[model samples]
Target: MTAAQRGRRVLVLERANKVGKKILMSGGGRCNFTNHFVSAENFISANEHFCKAALSRYSQWDFIAMVERYGIPYEERKHSQLFCLSSAKDILNMLLDECSDAGVEIRSHCELTSVSALDHDNSRYQLKGHQNQTPLQLACQSLVVASGGLSIPTLGGSGIGYDIATQFGLAVTKKQAGLVPFMFSDASKALCERLSGLAVEVEVSCNNTLFRENLLFTHRGMSGPVMLQISNYWNPGDTLSINLLPDTDIIQWLQELKQQQPRSLLRSGINQKLSKSLTSELQALWWPEEADKPLAEFSDRRLSEIAQKLAAWQLKPSGTEGYRTAEVTRGGVDTAAISSKTMETKHQPGLYFIGEILDVTGWLGGFNFQWAWSSGYSAGLNV
Candidate 1:
């Protein structure tokens, strides 16, 4: 929009039959467009400070203003994340309306099979591909590679972005699934299967990082906001420390429960705090020796041990579910190879990279979309 406002002709090429398929699916169709407090601290990148300039220049407030201008109703959710009150289609339509108003021509189903230098003497890019099975070729001076990253393949996520960066001699970093679920080994899978579909608010910690959100137990493994958030820092063989009871002081709470309900069975007493099924699972795992015993029968030392175990239960996941279920990818074109201020290639002129195509990956919620707006806005101002 900025480029068109500055009188530069703009054209957008979309490989999908429709633009913003992913956007339409974000936040359960009600798109989480931005967060109330978005900063460099909320993002992860190879060069940590690479996102400061663009994010500051085009903050969440700017995007909110656009949303308001379009009269798109929105609501604020947990963690200051904002979501559309109606549907994600509203945001997509607003963007399309803006592009149309600015005279930006959008050509959908224009997949570029190959992008290479037109000639050594000229600084133009020759794009070749078939649009609707018709021979398609184009030449342009300024090229913006916003092809996105590899995550959900059905959502048009692929490695084309990295391929383009490498083709242009730009450094592409190691990419991995971020905001994804974890899978357990065969031995541990049975536990998750038994607790499948059970969701509880808990703090899941790994690699000295902690996420206080809901952890959902799936038939295959674990998911939900907490697991997805911590997965960004998790690696193979890393053990996660989960605090099942974050709000209660387990030791003191256990003693009080035991004192108040001396004749009650440990399972029965615990069932009051947790679900009966979860309490059974915990008793089977933590206090198998005294699971059936009454609270009065348990010694102080034994109660302490159980409390300690519940407070910091450790588990090592076999691996993640991979990009098939990931929300966003971890890495992309190296930030060191791009100019932070303009999102332009330092070595290759007229070539800009933005959004998921870059190394910047935001946390769960609306951070990623905010990066898309910020980086895209930055590139627009310069390109």
Candidate 2:
């Protein structure tokens, strides 16, 4: 749409049967289009400054203005995440409408077999592909690879973008799953399974990075905003330090409670801070021998031990859920070879890499979508 708006004929070849399949399924069908707050700090990249230029040029406010122009109703959720009020289809329709107005053509189910430079100057390019099982070929002045990363295969995620980057002699970084849930194989797995469907607001930390959000217990592992956010920095064998009661100093609170209610059971006092089921599980795991002990019966040293557990519960995950359920891929084409200002490849003229296909990965909110809009707009202006 941006390219077409610039008076350049634009053709979008989609490998899936439809365009924007990921958009349709994002944010529980009501797509989180962008965030109220976005900065380069919200993204992780080999080149930390690579996204700054494009993002500054086409910020979230720019996209919001377009959404408002279309009169699309939206609402801001937790962490300034902006989501469509009705459905994600509204955003898709708006883009499609823009494409229509700009005379952009979209061809679905077209898979590119190969791409090559047509001249020594590399000013022209040749693309060979099959559109819906029929052989198709085209020549163009510019080729923009917006193919997304490998996260959800059912959503049409593929590595073709990375493959193209490598084919062009651009360095590709090691890829891994980001914004994914942690799967445990030890006793933690049983605990999570037993507490499946429970959601608790907590601060989960890994590798010195902390995220204060809701942690959800799943039958297979743990998920929700907190786990997904911290997963970006977590690696295998790294133990996660979870603060079940982050806002309160557990030791101080417990000591005061013991003085005020000397006869109250420890579980009863702790239960006020967490779910009874969760408290029970913690009691069994951390202080099974003192389950029946009252506050007064527990020594200060023992109370401190329990307080430490509540303040910093440790859990080591065997691994993540992998790309099967990850929200995004962690790495891709190295940003060193891509022009941050125009998103065009420095080594390969007329070739641009944008969105998840690059080494940039945003935080769990709407940062990723903002990158897509910004990078796409930057490339569109120059492509």
Candidate 3:
């Protein structure tokens, strides 16, 4: 749409039956299109500064203005995440409306099988593909690869963008699942299964990165905003430190409760903040002997130990759920070989890479969508 708006003839070839499948499914069907506040700090990239230029040029406000121009109702959630008030289809319809107005042609189920330079200076290119079984060929001067990354194959995610980058001699980085759920195989797995469907607000930390959000217990593992956010910083064999009671100092609160309510059981006091089932599980794991004992019956040292355990419970995860459930891919084409300002490959003139196909992954929320808008706009102006 941006390219067409800039008076450049644009043709969008989509391998899926329709365009914006991911957009239609994001944010529980109400697309979290962009954030209220976005900076380079919100993204993870091999070159930390690679996304700054494009983001600055086409910020979140620019996208918001477009949303408002279409009169799409939106609402802001926690952490400044902006989501469509009705359905994700609204955003998709707005984009399609813009494309239609700009005279952009979209061809669905057209896969590009191969591409080659047509001239010595690489000014022109030949693209060969099949549009639903029929052979197709095209020639163009500028090519933009927005094929996206490998995450949720059902949503049209593919590695064709990375393959094209490597085919052109551009370095491709190691890719992994980001913003994915963690699966446990140890005793924690049983605990999680037993407590499946339970959600608690907590601060989960790994590799010195902390995220304070809701942690949800699943039959297979743990998920929700906190786990997904910290998974980006976690690696194999890393232990996660979870603070069940992050808003309150457990030690002081417990001590005061012990003095004020001598007959109250430890489980009873903890049950006030945590669910009864979770508190029971913790009591069995941390202090089985004090399950039926009153607060005054326990010594201060024992209470402190329980407090420490509650403050920092250690749990190691077997691994993530992988690309099957990941929100984004961690790495892709190395940003070192790409121009940050225009999103055009330095070594391959007229070839531009944007969005998740690059080594830029944003934090959970609407950061990733913002990168798509900014990078797409950058390449649109130059392509």
Q: Listing every candidate in turn, what is its Cα RMSD in Å to the true structure after a full C-alpha superposition?
A: 1.5, 1.1, 1.3
TM-score of 3: 0.97
1-383 in candidate 1: lDDT tens per residue? 77777777888888889889889999999999999999898998989999999999999999999999989999999999999999999999999888888999888877788988765434478888877788788777778989888899888888888988999999998888999999998666888999999999998888878889999999889999999999999888899999989999999988998899998888887777788888888888888888678899988999999988788988999999999999999989999989999998998888899999899999998999999999999999998
TM-score of 1: 0.97
* Cα displacement (Å) at residue 209, model 2: 1.0
Q: Which ten residues in a row have the lowest lDDT in candidate 1?
A: 117-126
* N/CA/C clash count, model 3: 0
lDDT of 3 by residue, 1-383 (tens): 88999898888889899999999999999999999999988999889999999999999999999999999999999999999999999999999999999999999999889998878443477899999999999888799999989999888899999989988999998898999999999999999999999999999998878999999999999999999999888888999999999999999999999999999999999999999999999999999977889999888899999999999999999999999899999999999999999999998889999999999999999999999999999999998
Q: After superposition, how far is residue 92 of candidate 2 from its true place, in Å?
A: 0.3
Pairs that clash in candidate 2: none
TM-score leader: 2
Error of 1 at 286 (Å): 1.5
Predict model 2's lDDT versus the native. Answer: 0.93
Clashing pairs in 1: none
Residue 344, model 1, lDDT: 89
